[model samples]
Target chain A: MRSYRTSTVVALGLGLALLGTSAFAEAAKDITLLTWLGGPDRKVLDTLVTGFQAKHPDYKVKINVVTSQGDARGGMRTALMGGEKPDLVTNTWPAFRKELADAGILRDVTPVWTSKGWDKSLAKTWRDISTTGGSVYGIPYIFGYRSGIWYVPADLQKIGLQAFPTSYDDFLATFDPLRKAGFAEPIAMPAKVYAHSEWFETLLMRTGGPGLVTDLGAHKIAWTDPKVAEALRQYARLFGAKCCGDSKLMYATHWDDAADRIFVERKANFLQIGMWINARAISQYHLKPGTDYSLGKFPALGRGFDNASIIDAKEILATGIGSNPDGADAFLDYVLSADGANIIAKAGFTTPSSSVDASIYDPVAAASVRFVNEGDVRFVLGDLLPGSLVDEYRLALQQFIGNPTEANIAPTLERIEAAAARAY
Target chain B: MSAVDTRLPPPGARAAHRGSPGPAPGRRAWMPESATALLLLTPVILLFGLSVIYPVIETLRISFWEIRGLGRPRFVGFDNYLRLFSDPVFLGTLWTTLIFTVGVTIVAVTIGWTIALLCAFAPRQTSIFRLMIFATFGISEAVAGYIWIGIFRPGDAGLLNGMLSAIGLADLAQPWLGGANSALIALIITAAWSAVGLPLLLSFASVQAIPRSILEAAYMDGAKPLAMMWHIMVPLSLPGARVAIFLTLLSSLRAFDIVFVLTAGGPARATETVGFFMYRESMTQFNLGYGAAATIILLIGVLLVSTPAIAQRTKGAK
Candidate 1:
């Protein structure tokens, strides 16, 4: 009986000591950052967080990676409604910002922006897009240009093209001769949902300019509009080229598979993708930057929309509501500064902050910075639209890719318009 | 059957009269039995209330609302259900669900019943074959779907296409999942392949339970193999077969993983069944109310399709 009592007392004391230690650990955790940063993306984020912690040793930051972009968005939505929301969330897209802001689950960082004097450093377009009803909900972290064409410069030289084509006619003219030069397919087009949509979106931007793309994203204009039909016709014209081979080939190909054709397998010459393709080509395929492959502007198809670039800033850092708003703000301030941006640049990612010098970036990233700095209007396609409607748009474009005909385009657009009408 | 039996004491009274100091029939004899039954049923009843009853009630309640993501759910009355009739996508989803369920249930049950009968008459050493066939039941639905992906994948890399080309039937090796019409067939084939194990095991177990005396009698009475199967074995096994049918039907109606991994309801919403639609609405699109409404409709469909078989099973149980 005496031994039992003593053992119980000892066990109770040990349990109390362990519980107190865990409590201390919990109290010492200063902030939590929920992000979709994984694989190579984590390197820069980890460096920035470590730097922040070193500057302020009293603060300990916890990082929770939510796997993918869509999962992170969905998780943040659920976490906002539940307890235990993170202090800071990074890589949030514009699509989720307004909804979170409206739900009052996001803290307005406008005050932080003003106090830090960040309004002058951040790009005006990003600042405007991140603002919802005059409150900035997102802090721009990482940004880049999307829908840029990637081609092997040597392949282009072999086809007797001295420079990348700048106009629609010149672009189409290169395809046939490139095919005749023993290139099987001049362009590797993947009919996967996102790939097909990006192709159509690029064509639409060149055909009807940014205004039309904006209205479509806002759902103010239906997809069945004549302008959209014209864009579809243009896309079909390119897709039907002999240089494209059979559209059936696309059914088995994903976007990465299409990219592999040029960079890895050396089968195709050109691929229309984002600026990130350059880094992928360098790292994955071990291709030299200017010699093996290079970036070119997606040629302007019409007279009005000239040299326009659609930029997609995929990763945005924002604060959660009912969280440690002060800690979140402090971390955001630290990360958006010139020093922080340079750290991110060193890790091979571009930043939206103008305070970061263009020369700090690598040559490929420097080219993207030039696209933004050279008075090119940046637009994020479908950023304002609801996610479901965006899905409908992609699905419609995929169907059009499956069967590209004059007869099928109108009905496909109508179906997409019907989905858009119900988005609200 | 006779009114005079009411004048006599009930069965419990006769037993109680023979015993000493037990409760009288009119007063408290049933109390202890009832209490014991209540005690025994408590855990399952609590579980049923928690898992099945609560979610069902919540789903029914959410069906009348318009919920977007984790936003506040607003009551829209029957607007969600009423919109179903007008929404082309929902209507098409209903058609896809029906086609998938019917095709899978028929094909799986037929294969299962056929295999069960064959195994029932086979030599005793062929129990290994039964084990091998039933091993598929241990595989998860998602893994099964992935296994079929290699077979139905749409190029030279695909196992089926590769096999066809090697056998000099290259012209027939087209993209099997390229279009809506063909994608539906692929989904059905994959679903049936995964679903056959349940009915096979159930039918075999039930057939094995039949006494050998009946089979010997039928054999001695000069009943041929076909006649015995038609009139004896099949009739005896109908109860288990009906249960298997209902089980397979419900599972096929709720199949999302195989279709999700295979077609993703693509080639223009061709194979988008009710289950996939609900998932897309609730999880993907974050419209909980619409998804709830779809779930309720699918529930009604299952009940309507399986209620008769359930009643028959009950009668057979009695």
Candidate 2:
């Protein structure tokens, strides 16, 4: 009887200890995230979130997907000012990060960065883009390759071009043969606000090399530089030569249609866009990459000039405004870790942040890796300016492209300068 | 004494009694009644004050301020207003809105009046056609905008463009929404199409109420078809016509969805109306103060233009 009683007491004690641990585990932290996840992307995000939850069962997250366009960030700003903000927000444009920082709504995550070793894992370019005032505010979630020329295999074959050109003179020469063959337009250029901005970036990169744009974005260069004027003049020359489509059509036609004309209809030989352009072409036209089409960097300017590409990093930021601030930081840490980077790289995205191995990504994404590491890519322009100034510059570029004349250029540039000065 | 007074009360005594008054009622005496009426109307008054009057007042107040999104609204009195006046886009939008309003009003009212006249004189089975015609008014403006977009899509894949190409009129299949000059006109056509149904229904109701005997008498007195329409049907339908015009004018002035969805005030802001401008300023630009100021200006312009017409129509009705 003594032996039985002793055994029962031991079992009960063990049971009580397990119960205490289980209860402690059940006391999970909760977080709220606001994002713009819709359609197929929502499923991918859901999978990622579920994976996150499974790994950290002690933390619970609730996501609120807000459906909006252009006004989503503005609405969040209003909420931040009103003292009601989400713990995390996705799809934040770089221009507004300054405003949020200025407003003191964002949390300085430099400690989180150091603790998680992200400072060592992330690429310097990615770190540079996501940092403000020597403190990290966000993690680079997605990297988009923006500087490249798109062409059809058939058009290249017809023009006797063996491969895509890598120099400005050669690039212009390729277009001359196409124009001489009586192709109405060798390229499809849109005068829409966003489209015009892309063209301006392309011109800036092609003429002065991408370093000037990077310098301008970093506030190391002035807008009134002679190189800037030369770039504008080069764009005007192309506009005058009828190498591009009607400017009016630019206002109505979307970028997809422009891609369609280049890829499907074979109307245009070249299109300047980002990596997503290639993805859109593949999905829209069902064209196999490396066979039907391929990618190339924006041609080099001259000797000793580096072939510079444009890089835009999508960031995940932990905004301080809800329950479980620690949980938000934990989730961000998880995303910036090597494991999360592997998941993203497997999904056909470039993960240059040294956390993820390049061998894990598909060939297309691996190409982006090469572009960033081998090609020495730089961040896009207009990212350093305030949101209002960026909008004004976009509008000014749209106007200038539509009415490409020497008369309109000075006034447009002057207006942009005034807006930029006010911005600072 | 009572019987003699009752039997022999003279005009002089009655006049003196009637003329004698204890007090005189002046305009000030109407105050209490007016106050009671205002009090009774307080809910509606408050509603107008909140939704309409307050916004106008706030807009006028903010017009003098330099307010960005969710920031401290700073007073820069008249600077914004001055900038707006000097803005070419704003001026262009004003002109476009005016032209669009007038163009849509004329087309919508004319077609509606014609349809209503036909429906009034048609056979019994024509009620189905009338119903079908009037059914379009049930659709929301955004839906109507999208539907017309499918029809007027600039490419050959569009419904109208495909039809024209199939019928061997391919040469005429130019970009309908792609041109600056034709974009506003196309939007005007869409606005007319969406709005004509309401006026048609109103005019049909008024036309049916006209006395049939008067029409028969006119026919018997050797009235031709043209004369019968101009003299009999038109004159009787004038009241309905006036209401229809007023409604269409108001609708045209406030039209936003069609222009927004179809053109987005684009192709170089050629199709921008005051309503679209106000929305872009308020929502896209996040310049709520400036947007408010623009809204007030638009409201004042609309009221000034429409007040005389509304008063004239109301007086005519009386």
Candidate 3:
């Protein structure tokens, strides 16, 4: 009789232990966030996750960081297709949103936005970029000003150039003397397609005018337009110049590596980059912002749109279709909220939401914001164009840069036109 | 014993001579030997059907449809193929692939064969030399690509260009991976560097398998080093050499990651091969149907490239 009594008590204890363990497992809901952010940018995300977990003690956030955008896109696509969706994923702005929506991998967050009234806080352009076919698939976390050219004023002084060139012709002319002064490449350019397209689109916006570039990105304008061809020709000429560096080295160098040339090694006088470069400068080059360097505008080409800036709003974070979407939506809501935008702003990212206080931004980011706000803003052409056309543009531009001659210009344009025709 | 002829014969002899026909009182009915073998092979057959056969058939089906991402595919019979045939870029890519495959196969086989001959005939340090030559096989293709980038990198930082400058041949330092033909040449060298190991290992094994008596007889007949290699070792090792060349050709035809990491089919699509084109169309562009069509075309090209080697190997075997 004593043995039986002991067994009953032990059974009760085991049952209580099992129940407590299950309750503990249910307390902290695991939410996975996938992104391609690295360096200081990754730290910013980690801090945001910590803030979110602190605010919502019942939810635990897991971060999955990929090193490159291409890998991130492919990985997310596979995961969604394989039925293992990440709770939240940060993707390339408009392009990935369109692709994911078409694949039905993205959750419709329009209702979420309307419920929270978060759509009202976003810049109209950013809100429009996130919505496709009447559904909000993503929210802008950061906007990279692609028009900024990083230059050391001292380097320009050594090359006998007193000021940055504001006009296209003047910019082209500066290359010769800079080369003569033994600055073989006045500008450090990465051969990467995305990097190339940033400058290409900037040139297109300044030379072909924003209207035509917008039309071209939307497949409304033919790629063979004489104005478009002119832009390509101009871009080819600049790329082939002595100041653009050796085609071999430029083609082989990565975008981040090329940025390092100006920021750390001082190998080149200027680097065509954006606001995110500051993050890289601080993290990798150990350089101070504003004091170490400053931002300049892309040279104007007199196409009726002066002071226009190129913007890449590629980091659009959103909830995916799977388990813990409510939790994911809650996190994105926090990220896009005024408080969340403040966290992002303090971390040196340019938040698209106006609700966030702007004073937390560093001088370089503040300058970018002021320049973009004061001037006309346009999206990167590659971001707006379909994938096939983007690929064709890269191929055409790279080929033209490879052998930039007057004779090659016509064929390159024709080839690009042929590709554009098939995009739709 | 004659009266008890109902007794079974020796156990082994009885089993070898006759099969069981009916069920014993306590057991189930006997199955035929062939039927049992088929039953045993069922799991492998099912796995092959699920993994390999189903995908190939699905790809063929999808080749006739237009797929934009995971959306419902619309059947577009023969259109993708027609587009492929008419695509100037795809045609250019095909030409590039041909050059890449033929070039890598010929170069890798020749070099591997030459090295194998040296390893076979050398009287001293054969194992050490063999180890040194075969060490490259241990490196991955991606790593091999990065290693070659240092050599082929443009400008003063590059090993090749720096060496040229150091030797007063600075004028010859041009971007090895930037020009039209130059990019293709650089890719071929990288691919050969990655692929040569297999052929070397195989040819070495083949050379070792060659009966020493035949080589000695050739030596007795006054065969010199070159003559013996050309007349004796190579002819005897043709079978292994054929396999090595075929594998190299196959790998080169589908080469994607190396070109992707190295040139990305750039300097004006100068190095764009069919494999890279397919990846761009399918993964990058989300045009799975079009990519499927390109994949089928590449498969056919591979089959055409490998058919001769296979036939030769078969004839040799017979």
Candidate 4:
């Protein structure tokens, strides 16, 4: 009886001591951030929080995660509509940012941009892309190169090519020899939902340049525009080259399955995707970058838009409803600082801020940064379209992949046009 | 029917079957039976109105508006419904939902009823097998969907394709979920496999409820096993089968999770049902009015499927 009483007292004392210490160590002010990022991306956010808390000992970040699958936009909208007044939110979709801004959910940070001298670190292009209706709303901290083709160096060697193809014709020419070398389909096209559009989107940039992508995404140019049809024709050219497997196989494959075909199975030679494939290849397949595999920019189509690039960026947007505006502003500034940018680079993502050193990134990510610097970059087209139009556009694209002939291109473009008519 | 009931009932038992009492007019203040019954059910009535009735009314109200993506809703009256009827995607979903519901019901009920009849012959011997089959009913549809994804996955990595190659039938192996018809078929097969467990248990209970005396009489009359089963067990066990059909039809009409996990209403929306269409509209596109209209349509479908069975049961009770 005596021992039991003593143990209970000791347990209560320890609990109180731990609670008191935590209470004392707590920061005086806090700002909340809402996001749907998980896995390695979540870890990156945790690291940023640590670095920020250390710098601003009196301020803290409280992260509210909205758990979701597939598209995170739906979950974010639900959280906001359900009355979650987060101070900041990590966003990627320009159209989504526009929606939030139109709904009075986002705050214009142009004043912060001018006062904090953010133009020295971020380029004009980042600011321009982050702006909606002449008001800037977010800070783009990390970006991924979307136009690169992921391939094993050895697969190209199998067909006796010392390097990846440099032109569109040369790239298509490798399929026959690659087939002869026991690779049935040189490219694993994942049309299960969306990844197959990566090829077509880049081809659009190649054929019509970034301006056409911008115009078509905003429906300023109808989907039936000649430039759009010509881009689809260019997309059809890859199918004419016998580049992928049957329509059924493509329709059944997802991005992860295609990644397996490239890395684990080695049954295919190339996959066009964003920079997340680099992390996936390194961690999941345990392959080293630049040694076992490397990224190649999409082959030049020899159009006037040969230098254009397509990319996706993760941006932090300020909200209009939070109480801790100061804490949120300080966090945004720190994200662009040298320390924050380096932490991002260390986590295997490329940062847009000039403060980040190129040496901190892995070879693949470094190449992506170099490629972005070498071209005019546009956000990935799918992320720029409204929600209503985007679904219809992808579904129409799916139908086109089923039969990628010249005859099918016009009808496909018309289908997307019909949806865009109602979207706006 | 009257052979076993010739004995007389004692005292109050005779009058008990006829009436409790017409009215308590001669007694002290008394409450009517109907009124007393309603009083007893008040809590349940209120609970039902709160839990089930209010949300349905709210949904119907929302279906009349034009609510789009957190935007201010304008009352559009019947425009959303009119749009749904004309929309090719929604029309396609109705057709797909019909085919999916019918396909799942036919496949599940047939297999379950057949297996249950066979299991009735030796319940003790097949106890483990019956348990295993019924256990599948307890599995979550989402988990079952992922398991089928591995089986139906494209290329040689998939189990079905691998088995085909092992059997020297490699030419027959195709992407089961890639084509339109094939994906719908695969979805039906998965839904039926998941749904069969319930019908099996229900039909088996009904079969077990068959009186032993009848089976013995049929056997003593030199009836064959198949004959006794066809003539005796089939008709007697139909009430359970009817209930199972009503239930399976209701569930299959609202099928979403399996389709979501399996095909996601893809390959150009070939396998999309009304439930998935509702989700895509409401949750994904944030078209609350349009999605609510779809839900109300699905609810009507469920009522149509269930009304016949319910009417027949109600008539029997009367």
Which candidate has the top score in lDDT?
4
Full candidate order by lDDT, most accurate first:
4, 3, 1, 2
Candidate 1 recovers a fraction of native contacts equal to: 0.21
* TM-score of chain A, every prediction, order shown: 0.88, 0.84, 0.83, 0.92
Q: Model 2: per-residue lDDT, tens digit, B24-133?
A: 42212334445766888999989989998886776788777876765667888777777778878788988999999999989888998888887777837678887887
Q: State the C-alpha RMSD over the true interface residues for candidate 1, after superposing those residues.
A: 2.7
Candidate 2 residue lDDT tens string, A1-424:
9999999999999999999888755533767777665653455456557768888987887877765544466566555555656777765356566566666657888888877777776767677667776767777777777776667766767788888877666777776788776554687765443665665676676667656776666556666677777777767766765667676566655566567667765667777666776567567688777668877666666634445566666677777656667888888877766777777776656665677877876455566567667555555665555555666677677778778887777777777777777655
Which lDDT tens digits does candidate 4 get at residues A287-327?
99998999998999898887778999999999998877778
**Candidate 1, residues A1-424: lDDT per residue as tens digits?**
9999999999999999999999876664568877666866778889888988887786777887664323356556555555656777765456677677677667777777889888777767678667676788657777767657788888889888878898777888888888878876788776644665666777887778767876787777888899989989988887666546465556545566677767766677877766668678888988877677777777777657765667776554566542456777777887787777888888778888776766777666777677666544445565657867777877777767767889999999998998888886
User: For each model in turn, which proportion of the native inter-chain contacts is also found?
Assistant: 0.21, 0.24, 0.38, 0.52
* Angstrom error at residue A346, model 4: 3.1
Residue B265 displacement (Å), model 4: 0.7
**lDDT preference between candidates 2 and 3, better one:** 3
Please write out the lDDT profile of model 4 over residues B87-206, one tens digit for every residue. Answer: 999999999999999999999998888889999999999999999988878888888899999999888888999999999999999989899999999999999999999899989999
Question: Candidate 2: misplaced stretches above 4 Å?
Answer: A1-28, A40-42, A179-183, A209-211, A214-222, A303-306, A342-366, A375-384, A402-412, A419-424, B1-64, B123-136, B149-155, B158-172, B305-318
* Reference-based lDDT, residue B30, model 2: 33
CAPRI classification of candidate 3? acceptable
**Deviation of model 1 at B181, angstroms:** 0.7
Q: Clashing residue pairs in candidate 2, if any?
A: none
Q: Model 2: how far is B246 from its true place, Å? A: 2.4
Each candidate's TM vs. the true structure?
0.82, 0.82, 0.84, 0.90
